[model samples]
Target: MFTNKGKDVVEGSSSASATDHRQQKQASQPAPLSRYESQKRRDWNTFGQYLRNQRPPVALSQSNSNHVLDFLRYLDQFGKTKVHLQGCVFFGQPEPPGPCTCPLRQAWGSLDALIGRLRAAYEENGGLPETNPFASGAIRVYLREVRDSQAKARGIPYKKKKKKRKLMKANLDNNPNISLQQS
Candidate 1:
């Protein structure tokens, strides 16, 4: 009976210590920042600054889809096409190198990813998911229109690569019946 009681006491103390240690550890560490949080913050700041320079300054929360559209269009003005980037790399010259076959517009995939990141950042920064302007149907439709227009202009279809299936390896040693085949 005494031995059992001692064991219970030891177990109780160890568990208590463990709980205390966990609490302490949790208190000491800060929560991890969301992915691309810094980049999102920088983008927001740049947009905010742009707004401030306008005739009438606008806050990020109060801005509508039109403002977002304008911002995206503004980004397009500075975008370099893959061909342009290649020229810059090959010639070791800055952008505005000799023109090439590709259009000057940004790639649909890159713009889509940027929008996704912005949407996530908007939600993370206290914007409601349902009302997020970045994730609005209008924005999606605009992107689709842009993509279609660019594809039509360039005569190239935009295609995303499909994820490859992972091969499952069987434990041949444990399952003696399984035979390894060399292809």
Candidate 2:
């Protein structure tokens, strides 16, 4: 029962009308990101940059390492693309709350692409792409052509196979009864 508005709290409102009102109220309230969660994201961004600038990528848990690399990749990509690229380092975490939000990978890709475009523009305007750290090795390449190229030059990761164990010649010589198998 209502007194201030002088209207029945429930009986006065039709069931369908009440449902519509409830839906509208729910729709208007924006979901908020919590402070702790916001701080975590900020920390992640900071940590990402730290990992990226590292000349030698530090040994870390797979997920943490990947996260940092992803962030670094994004930063390098972002720096190249964003205009007024003057700073050697970006030092601050973003404000905890902002309208902008993106998945870590998506952010990385967007930033990388943006950097690529910026790098191209810089070169077009007579700026040297070679000087930019983010410039891909392929961009700096002067080679005309090659049949097969080494992956090492391109910074690709690979695993080397273990060498097969070899039997000692002395051991073979000592064992007269043992015949060597066909090679």
Candidate 3:
């Protein structure tokens, strides 16, 4: 170190300059969006576009579950997944032998995922968590209805697969020493 009157300078300032460069780089560029965040932004923009296309241009503040339901129905027009009706020959079959006149609607899983993204986006965009339209009971009921109808129409039963732990527990109940019998 050398001192010129009251000013002192370090012999090696590479580390200091490197840190400064890092700070400047960080300040110049924003962080990249994660997959989920990108999806949320897209969903929010889509909802905003839907609102703008409304008859009177609905505001985000005035949006409700009803508007969400309408948007969901509107999306049905673009769905590519086929959901068989009860009267269809392929109803209740996992794989249809031949194509029928079944209607194409948005898959239940896709709608569920979209609703999840929209719900998160609504809160992230300054909407009150309590007043979030996506959090309404109507939205839940609509999702449930969509899930059930889609399940029935597609003949895919909506049953959760049981975990192996539950089966192990059942075996443990039948034999008190089962837990200690592991080799």
lDDT of each: 0.70, 0.42, 0.88
For residues 33-123, write the lDDT of model 2, one tens digit per residue. Answer: 6864454455544553565566776432222324433544445443422221112132122222332222222232344444454444435
- Candidate 1 residue 78 Cα shift, in angstroms, is 0.8
TM-score of 3: 0.73
Candidate 1: tens digits of C-alpha lDDT, residues 1-183: 225644645657777999999999999999876657767777777777867776788887887778778888878867775423333333323343456554466667778878887787778778898878888888899899877665544446667676442332446556788776767
Task: Assess candidate 2 and give its lDDT.
Answer: 0.42
Residue-by-residue lDDT tens digits, candidate 3, 3-63: 7578786757855997899999999998999999999999899989999999999999999
Most accurate candidate by TM-score:
3
Q: State residue 132's C-alpha deviation in candidate 3, in Å.
A: 1.0
Q: Could you give the candidate ranking by TM-score, starting with the highest?
A: 3, 1, 2
> Against the true structure, what is every candidate's RMSD?
14.3, 19.5, 8.8
Candidate 3: segments with Cα more than 4 A from true spot? 1-26, 160-183
Error of 3 at 53 (Å): 0.4
Candidate scoring better on TM-score of 2 and 3: 3
The alpha-carbon deviation from the true structure for residue 8 of candidate 2, after best TM-score superposition, in angstroms, is 20
User: Candidate 1, which segments miss by more than 4 Å at Cα?
Assistant: 1-35, 82-103, 158-183
